[model samples]
Target: MKHQSTGESLSTYSPLLLFICFLISLPISAQDEPKISVGGALRFNYNLSSWKEGQKNRGGDFGYDMFRVNFNARFKGVYLNAEYRLYSDAFGGGVLKQGWMGYKFSDIDEIQIGLTQVPFGIQQYNSHNWFFNLTYYVGLEDDHDMGLKYIHAGEKFEYHLAFFKGAEELNFGSETESSTSRYSYDVVGRNKEINQFNGKFVYKFGDKAANRLGVSAQYGSLYNLDTKENGDHYGLAAHYEFSQDRWNVKAQALTASHNPKNAAGENRDVLKFGAYGAPYQVAADFNLYSLAVSRNIPVNLGPVSNLEFYNDFGYMQKQKSQFTDSYMNVTGVLVTAGQVYTYIDYAAGYNHSWLGGNFKDDFAAGNPDAKWEARFNINIGYYF
Candidate 1:
C-alpha cells in the first residue's frame, strides 16, 4: 500500500551537512585531554529462502547487512557519541543512526539530549537473535527518536525516562518504491508535531543481576498540519529474564493501540508503524509475545572460543479479524572468537510473520494463504 507524497524534497547536501557539523565540533583540550575512541562493525550475510508459489522469487543471495562506524569522546563528565551507517539499498543507504551529547552524573546516572533510542519496550541489545524481536518491526522495540532522556541505575532498580519530539525523517525514494524509509518510517507523518513520552522500569534480582523483570510504556500525540488531523497512540509491555550458569530464558508481552484520524480510508497517510507497513487504521490494536532460550555449549573448535545455541519464537495476534495473525521461529548457533562472530540459522514463518519482509499482499488480495516459508542464513561479522 502506497500514498501520495506531500512534503517538500530534502536538500541533496543534507548528508554532507551533518557530516561537516560532526567534524567541526571536535573537543579542544587544554590540560585534561579528552579520550577519543573509534569503533565499528562490518557484517556479511548469505541467505537462501523458500517462498510461496505465488510470491515473488527470493533465493540464494549475498550482501552486506551493515557497515557502521561509531565515534565517542569523553572528557570530565561530558561525552559525545555518534554512529554512521553505510547500508544496502534493501535497508536504506547512508544515514546517521545516533548522534547525542550527554553528561554523566555518576557511574550509573546520565542525562542525554539529541537523537537516541525510545525506551518503550525490551531493550534491543538484550535479544539473542540478530534480527531482534518482532517488536522492532512494529516500532515498540529497537526504534530510535529525537528526544531528551534521563537514566538512573541503582542497586536493585533501573529506570529510563524520555520525552521525544519525533523520529528522524530519511526518505530514500518515492513512497511507492521499496525503500528503507517505507519500512522504518516512524509513527508520525510529515508536517506533524508529535509529542512522545516513554518510560521503562526494571527490578533486578540479586547482586549478580542475573534475573530481572521490566515494565515499559509509551504515549504519543500527533498534530498533522497537512491533513489537519490528530492521532494518538499508547503502548504497554512487560518482560522477564532469568539466567543460570549455562542457560538463559527471556520473554516479553506487548500490546499497543494506534488511532489514526483517517484509519478507515482506502488511500491515506500511512500509519507508519504498528504492524509492518500497515495502512492507516487497518489494525487499530496489536498484541505481541516473544520468547528466547539460549545455552552455552562446552566444546570449542579451532579459533572459536565460545559456542552458543538459541531459539526464538514470536507471535502476533491481530485485533482486527481481517488482518491475519503471524508466527515466526528462528533457531541458530552463534560462534565467537575475539572480535569475530558468526551465525548459522534456520528461520521459518507464516503470513507476514518474519521481519525480513511483509507478506500481507495475499490477504489484501482476498486470497488467504497458509503456505510455510523458510530461510537459511549464514551471517558473519567482525568488530574493530
Candidate 2:
C-alpha cells in the first residue's frame, strides 16, 4: 500500500493530541444518565505467497494482522465515536481510524462533524473478495477524509451529504514516493481545496426480498505545493444491493475523471494515478465495475458454527484504447464461531491487475508482459 505523507510534524501528531484531549475532557455524570463503552478487535494472518517474474518478496510469512480500539459515548442528544488503529511497519502504523461527534436532530436525521468515512459507493465492505476491488485501490471506495457529514433516513429513502477538507494526511513534499502511496488516492500530492463535496442517495423496495438502488457522486480540487499548480477530480457511481435470508448480492459501476497538473517538467496531457509518491501516469478517464455474491451454509463443523462462501469479480478499463485493461477474481470461504473467525481466500489477477493490490504497491507484479498471477491467504481474527 502506498500513501502520501504529510511533510510537517504537526500534521502527524495533531489528530492524536486532539483525540487525547477529547478523552481527558470527557465528563462523567453521577446521575448515570450518560452511557459509555469501550471495545476493540485483534487480527492475525498466516500466509504463503508467490510472486511474478519481476516482483520482490515470496514464500510464507506470519505476524500481527491489526489491532483497533474504539470508544463510544452518549449523553442527551449528543454522541461521540472514535477508534485508533495500530499496525507494524509491514502493515502500516498507529493512526486514528475514525473520530466523530454527532447531534441527533430527530430519530431519522443527524449531523456529524470530524473525520469519517466518505459516504459514497458502499458504506462499509465494498467487495466479498479478500483483496476487495479496483475501486478500493484507486480510493473511490472505503475512503476516509476529514469532513462535515449529514445523514437523513426515512421509510423508503436515505440521503448522505458531506463536505471534506481533503484526503487525510496527504503528503505533498514527496508526492510520487512509493512509501506514502497506501490508502487514499492522493496521487497529485496536494491537499484539496475546501470545495470537496460528496453526495449519495438510496431508495429501498421489496420488503420480503430486500432491494436497494443508489447513486453517488464526488467533486474535489487538488492544489500541489511543489509546482504551485492545481488539479481536478470528479466521479459518478451507481450501485444495487439485494438480500434474502442467507443469500446476498451487491454490484456497482463507476466512472471517474482526473485532470492533474503536469509535474514541473512533465507533459500536461498525462495524469497521475495510484498514490502521490508512487503513481502511474495514464489517461484522464477510467471506469470500474464490481460484483459479488455470497451464501451462508447452515451446517456446523467443529468450532466453526457459521460458514459462508463468496465470489467476487472486478474489471477496470482506461479511456485510452492502448492502455492494458485489468480484471480480478476472488473466491473465499469464511467461518466463524463466536468471536473467533477465519478466512481462506484464493485470488487471481489478470492483465495488469495485482492481487493484494489494495494493501500495497504491486507495480512489480503488474507488468504488462505478465499474463496472470495468483495468491492464497489464510486469515484469523478475534473481536471483543
Candidate 3:
C-alpha cells in the first residue's frame, strides 16, 4: 500500500517539475539567442518652388526644408525605437515620430509600450521602404501618442490593438471665436481633447506562383469629444510577382469616415484608389516608371542614389452639399549620398466655388466665389 501511494505522488509531481524546467529554460534560451544591435537613418529634403493659378498653396520657397532622424536598438526579445523630425517653417519644430519599447514572444506575438506609431495600416508596418518607387497619400499620419499594443501573427492572419490620445495636440479654444475659428480649433486641437482607441486586422493568401493578396481594416474612436464622434477606415491590397522575373504588380483601395473635428476637417464620403507595376533589370541600370492619383502625394524620387526627381498631383470634384472644388500640382527633386537626402519642390494649385446655393448658405455664408493660391517648399533630412 505504501509503495503504491508513493508511486502516485511521484507521477503527480513529475508534470509540475517539467513545467518548472520549461519556465527556467525560457530566459536562458532567450539570452542565448543573440545580443542586441543599434542602428538608424537620417533623411533630409529641400524644396524650391513657384506656384501659379490652378494649384494648391504650400507656402514659402528656399527654406531649411524638413529633417528626419531615427534611432533604434534591438536585442533578443526587447527593442527601443525613436524618431525626430524638423519641418522647415511649420509648427512643432522638433517632434517625436515613434518612441517605443517592444517585446517579442517567439515569432508570433509582440507587445509594445510608449508613444509609437498607430498600427492601423500597411504603411505603418513598412514605412522604412524608401527604395520602392511607389507613392501613396492615404496613409496614417505618424502621430506619437501614449499607447500599449498587442500583435499576433500567423501564416495567414495578423492583428493589432492600440489606445492613444485622439488628437496629437489638445485644443482648448477660447470663447468669442466665430464658427470658422471654433471649427478650426476643434479640428486642429485648440479645445478639449479626447482619448482614442484603434484596432486593425489583416489576412493574406495565394502563395503559389510567387503571388499574394491581402485585406486590412482599421477603426478609431474618440471618447471625450462633445459629440463623441468616431472615425473608421479600411484598406484592401493585392500583390503579385512572376517567378524568375523582375516584374511586380500591386493595387490598393482605401476608405475612411469623415469626422469634421479631425485635421483636414472636411466631412465627406471619399474613396481613394491606387495601382502600380514595375519591371526592372530589363534595362541597363533598372529604369522605372510609376503613375498614381490621390488626395495627396507625400514623397517622390527617381532611381538615382545621388540625384533624383519626382512630382505630386491631385484633383477633387465638388460634392452635392459642398460648394467648392480643388486641384493641386507639385513636382520636386532629391539628392542623396551617404546618409543625407535633400529635396526641392515647386507647387501651384487653386480652389473654386459657386455662391448663393443652399450649401453655400449653410456653410460659407456667401463668403466668396473663388480663390487662387501658390506655394514652394524645400526640405532636408539625414539618417545614421
Point to the candidate with the largest lDDT.
Answer: 2
Query: Can you write out model 2's per-residue Cα lDDT over 298-345, one digit (the tens) per residue?
Result: 766777787889998888776655455677878998888889878888
What C-alpha lDDT, on a 0 to 100 scale, does residue 231 get in candidate 3? Answer: 41
Cα error, residue 246 of model 1, in Å, equals 2.8
For model 2, the stretches where C-alpha displacement exceeds 4 angstroms are: 1-33, 52-59, 170-185, 188-194, 267-283, 351-366
lDDT of 1: 0.68
User: Which stretches of model 3 miss by more than 4 angstroms?
Assistant: 1-46, 52-61, 66-69, 74-76, 87-90, 125-139, 153-156, 169-187, 190-195, 203-216, 223-252, 258-320, 327-336, 344-380
lDDT of 3: 0.39
Models ranked on TM-score: 2, 1, 3
Across 86-184, the per-residue lDDT of candidate 1 in tens digits comes to: 776545567777788887667898777777877776675446776665566566666777667889988799999887765664443333222234333
Q: lDDT for each of the candidates?
A: 0.68, 0.69, 0.39
RMSD of 2: 6.3
Task: Report RMSD (Å) for each prediction in the order shown.
Answer: 6.8, 6.3, 15.3
State candidate 1's TM-score.
0.80
